[model samples]
Target: MRIVVPAGGIGGARFLRGLKAALGIGADLTEDDPTITVIGNTGDDITLFGLRICPDLDTVMYTLGGGINESQGWGRAEESFAVKEELAAYGMQPTWFGLGDRDVATHIVRTQMMAAGYPLSAVTEALCDRWRPGVRLLPMTDDRVETHVVVADGDGGRRAIHFQEWWIRHRAALPALEIVSVGAEDAKPAPGVVEAIDEADLVLLPPSNPVVSIGSILGVPGVRAALERATVVGVSPIIGGAPVRGMADACLTAIGVETSAEAVAAHFGPDLLDGWLVDTADAGASVEGVTVRARPLYMSDPDATAAIARAALDLALELKGDRP
Candidate 1:
């Protein structure tokens, strides 16, 4: 089976790990695992200390690659802060975002690759060559596009802020009035992205933040249009009208979106999603053009995450007609 997943940072990476375990247990993927391709959101990427930092890309790389700090689900494990200290010693601006000494090596390599005439998509592939993440990880766009949050200033003035600062510095404490992908209007999907989607038997949406994670992926030209032709199923991150894991509420509030499973489904819309999985807590939530199944969406263990992933794949296979 060929599978394609559009994913975000931490949430998306974790779900993929579970999904891989589930696929491992099934007959479809054993000696020859299903060909899985991931189009990771790059909107949260930022340039820091003259080095390009792709948070979502690195999150997927470290997690799927096995170097992840399991507890944090993002950076490297057994990491140090020596470089962070040195940078801080120089009075660098906006030092709130933590960068580990070991993690800096990744940024260094990526920056080097980019400066040597490679797009982020190419740079990501080179990095993944080391991890052998078991799936083809591609950036949403080779072009530059950053997601910025429009927030209300203390003086009542509205201004756009970098996604990293909004997420790490203030921790999404302030209300975001709007969300924008800075260069999406003209951005094209990276090479091989369309082919992966076109040839996939099924497409999965990880339980990532909709506003920036999946939303940013969709912002790329032809991404949503490609999904319009593939089988798509999404696991709800919101268990009972709130994110089971993160501060998704802050993201939802940005565009006046609600915090319910129903709201999340609406955000993606029935036109794009063939099936939606929600927790048992959200049973009977009607989502148009999508089959709603209420089950446990939490990944308490590898077993639980695998089960949910299998359930989602089964649903996608059963509802292939939703494809255009």
Candidate 2:
């Protein structure tokens, strides 16, 4: 079996770990091994100190490879921030974003490879070669596509800022006028991205930020068109009325979507998604032309998350059978 997942950062990474467990990849089993391909969102990629940092890609790689800090759910395990501290001591600007010593090495390698003229996909593959994340991790696009937020400048004007600046520095506290995926229109999917979607038995959209994560992936030229051909299932990031993790409500509001499970499902629409998974708290939630299943959606641990992944796969299988 083949499964293709379009994912973002923390939530997507955690859910992927559970999905691998559910597939019996980590277990001592030989049968029912599925080839999983993760299309990671690169819209969050940023250049800090002239080093490229692919946050979502690294989060997925570290989380799946068992090197992610379990507590914070991002960055390296047992990490030290001496580099960041020293930079701050030197009176550097933009000190709010923390870059740990171990994580710095990743950025160094990626930036070096990028400077050598390799595309982002090749750089990501080289990084994953060491992590061996068990899945084929591919960037959504090799082109430089960034998510920028247009927000009030407090001077009766608006200015565009990187998504990380609005997210990390301001904490999405500033009201957003628009969220733009800069360069998305001209960007093509990374190598094997469209093919992975085209050849998949199932496509899974984990509990990632719809506006910035999955939305950015879909914003790539042919990604959404390719996804329309597959049996797609999505797990709602919102539980009852709030995000399970992170400030997804702010992103949803920026995109003018209601922070409800049903609304998110409708936003993706029935044409793209065949089945939708919602939390047990939203049992009565429904959307037209889409099969709805309510289950315990809290990814509290690997076991709990694996159960949710299994439920989504089962629903996809059922939906696949129902197709004429």
Candidate 3:
């Protein structure tokens, strides 16, 4: 019962925790009986202070490894910010992003590995070696595919900023004119990404940021085509005209899609998505060629989130039956 998931940061990681719980896998499970393979979005990877900081991938790894900060939903638990504070004392630029001391160690290791001529996929695997996140996590691409947001400057000019700058610095307050994947046109899916999708019994799209998260992974060459041949089910990030978490509404609006479960499902479309799960509030929503199911999508706790994961898996199986 292999499952493939295209995921972003916090939301994706949390949903995966639930998925593991649903599969009766413990957080400390170190065995290779991984039924899940997570293809993490690397578009949010940024080079800061000469260290490569993969926010999305690290978030997933930490969360699944039981080292994630529970309240903030990112960064390391019991983290200290002495390094960031010292850098600020030195009057560094772009001090808006927070990097804790413990988290910086990860960036250091990743950067060192990358500097030694290791691709991000290999670096990620090496890092995961210590964390041993239950799932077989893979980066969406080994290439440098960054998500840049084109925003109007105060001087009435538009400039593209890294997704982190727009998301962390301005909190997506500036309206994004366009969300561009800087290298997606030439990026290839990571080594095992396509194979995971092709050999999966089911593929799940967690409720992450559609534009820069799951959307970025799909933008990688051969990913969407592979998905078209798999049984894929997506859990809606939007519920009742609002995002369940994060600023996904802004991302959707930038792409000219309405912030609704139905709109998002239609955006993914029947071509790649076989089934869609929306919150109970959106039970009336429907897409053209996708089977829709309604359930409580709020992942308030492990139990609640596991229930949602079960529902999504069940829906995917049901849809697979309808396919020829």
Candidate 4:
């Protein structure tokens, strides 16, 4: 089946790995395998030290490419930070966001290619040639779109900061007064993004941050409309009234949505999502006009994660069958 997944960083990457396993694929993918296209969220893309860094894209690439650090769930495995130390010795600002030596090479390559006038979609394709992530990964938009969080300035004022800074530096400690997707108003969906969704037999939304990750992808001009016409199912990031990981409650609060499986399903609404999956802990959860089912959501291992992915795929297929 042709599947399209709109994903964020860690959670999305892990879910994608499980999806691959569920399809019975091994480490190396071959021709005649199922087609899965991943529309990676790029709203968290940032330029640091004159190099562009696409965190979500890299996480998905590294995770699926079998180069991910299992413990951290992000960054390259066996990675070192010699470059970061030298930069700090030179008194480079923003030491909080450290770039590992191995990871910096990717940013350098991407920066050089973009300087040579290649759009991010082309750059990502070239990078994937090496990782061979086994899926067609595309950025949500080639245009610069960033998620900025508005936070209290500590002086009784409010200020806007990049989402990464707010996430990494402040740890989402300060409440978010607002979350804005800067430049989304004019940004078009990246190449192949609309077609992937339009031509998909099923679309999956992994357990990613609803506000910044999936929300940012949908914020792109035509992505939501395309998804609305497809069979879409989402795994709830919220479990037992709290997020499975990350401070998604803070993000949900920023947008005035409750941190619950039912609420998130309701936020996406029946118009876009055909089915929703929540943890067995949240068994009785329900959403108006959307099919909700209970399942184990924690991706403890490859086997468990694959089961979750299989459940979502089955739900989408069932919903597709129910449609005219």
Candidate 5:
């Protein structure tokens, strides 16, 4: 089966491992691989040290490819900071964002590829050539759409900062008055993105941060339309009025959304999501248009994560009324 998974960082990457395992088991295949297509969020992309660093995309790529720092949930394993330290010694500013040397190598390759007139989708495929993640990973768009947050700076004035700066540097301490995808208005979806959604047997939205991650990816031209027309299911990132991880509350609040499953469902609405999966804890959250199923949502371990993965797909299948 062809599956199109729209995911963000960390949580999205973790669920994929289970999904890969489940598909293998279900098919009775030795090699647990599916024709998976991942539409990764590029909102976390930041230009640091004159290189474009896509954190969410890299997180998914490395995690699935066995190159990620498992504990940190991002960046490379056995990472070194030699380059960062050297740059710091030269008195570089904005040292708040951690870019290790190995991670820098990724950025370098991405930059060089882009400079060679390749779109981000093509560049990512080329990079994944070595990772062999057993899936086709595509950026939502190759356009220069950046997610920026309007926050109150230290000067007691409001200004829009890059999503990375708002999330990493200040750690979402400051309230975000606005979130904007700077180039989304004109950005078109990547080459295979629309086709993947249009032809997907199932579309899964993992428990990724809603606002900047999935939301930003959706901000691109054709994504929301594709989801609106596809067999789509979304797992809640917010459980019991709080996110299981990350500072999603800040971004949710920025758009006047309360940190609740109900609010998130309203934010995404039925136009995009056909089935919505929440934790058994938030089973009471039901709406008119979407099918709501309750189950454990925490990825505390592989078994637990796999259960949620099953719940997510099972709910999708139940809604679609398909055994496979």
Candidate 6:
């Protein structure tokens, strides 16, 4: 089976891990194993200290490659912050975002590769050579697309800030007037992105932030159309009235969408999404023209996450069978 997943950061990475387990592949994938293509969100990409930081992509890579800090769901395990401390000691601005020494090496490599005229897609593939994440990870766009938040500037004015600064520095406390994809309008889908969606037997939208993560990928040209032609199912990030993790509630609110499983499904709509999975707590949730199934959505552990992934796979298979 060919599976394509459009994913974001921590939640998406962990869910992909479970999906691998559900498929009985894990890291022992062979030539005959099912192909999993992960279209990672790059909206969270930022350049810090002259290093290109692809947070979401690295999160997915590290988590799957067995080098992730499980407790924080990000960064490298056994990470040290000597570089960050040194930079802070120099009075560098925006010190709130932690930059680990081990993580910095990855950024340095990515920055150098990009500087040599390599596109982000190629750079990602090169990095994956080391991680061997057991999946083909592609960025949604090779162009420099970034997520920006519009917030009050405290002088009766408004200013746009990078999504990272807003999320990490302000902790998203400032209400977002608008969440903008800075370069999405002109950005083309990264190589193989459209192909992965169009040719896949199954496509999954993990329990990632719908607004800035999957939403950003959908913003890329031709992506939504490709999804419309496939059997696309999404696991709800919203469990009941709240987000499973992250500040997704804030993101949803910024877009004027209620943070509910049904609302998110409605937001994606039936034209793009064929199936939706909600937690048992969100049972009875319904979206017109979409198949909604209630399951345990909390990815509390590998076993639980695998079961949830299995439920999504089963739903997709059942829906696919009925397509004829």
- How many backbone clashes does every candidate have? 0, 0, 0, 0, 0, 0
The lDDT per prediction is: 0.88, 0.94, 0.94, 0.95, 0.87, 0.95
Per-residue lDDT over 205-283 for candidate 5, one digit per residue giving the tens place of the 0 to 100 score:
9989999888988899879999888878899999999998999999999999999987798789988888899988899
Per-model TM-score versus the true fold: 0.96, 0.98, 0.98, 0.98, 0.95, 0.99
Candidate 6 lDDT for residue 162: 97
Q: What digit string (tens of lDDT, one per residue) describes model 4 on residues 1-324?
A: 899999999999999999999997665777878899999999999998898999999999999998899989999999999988988999997888858889999999999999999999999999999999999999999999999999999899999999999999989998999999999999999999999999999999999999999999999999999999999999999999999988899999999999999999999999999999999999999898899999999999989999999999999999999989
lDDT of model 5 at position 275: 89
lDDT for model 1 comes to: 0.88
lDDT by residue (tens digit), candidate 6, 53-85: 999999999999999999999999999999999
Candidate 3: what lDDT?
A: 0.94
The TM-score obtained by model 4 is 0.98
In model 4, which residue pairs have backbone atoms overlapping below 3 Å? Answer: none
Model 3 lDDT per residue over 1-324, tens place: 899999999999999999998888875665655489999999999999998999999999999999999999999999999999999999987699899999999999999998999999999999999998889899999999999999998798999999999999999999999999999999999999999999999999999988899999999999999999999999999989999999999999999999999999999999989999999999999998899999999999989999999899999988888878
Q: How many steric clashes does model 6 contain?
A: 0
Q: lDDT value for candidate 4?
A: 0.95
- Measured over all alpha carbons after superposition, the RMSD of each candidate to the real structure, in angstroms, is 2.1, 1.4, 1.2, 0.9, 2.5, 0.7
Name the weakest run of 10 consecutive residues (lDDT summed) in model 3.
Answer: 25-34
Off by over 4 Å in 5: 25-33, 154-156, 322-324
Stretches > 4 Å off in candidate 6: none
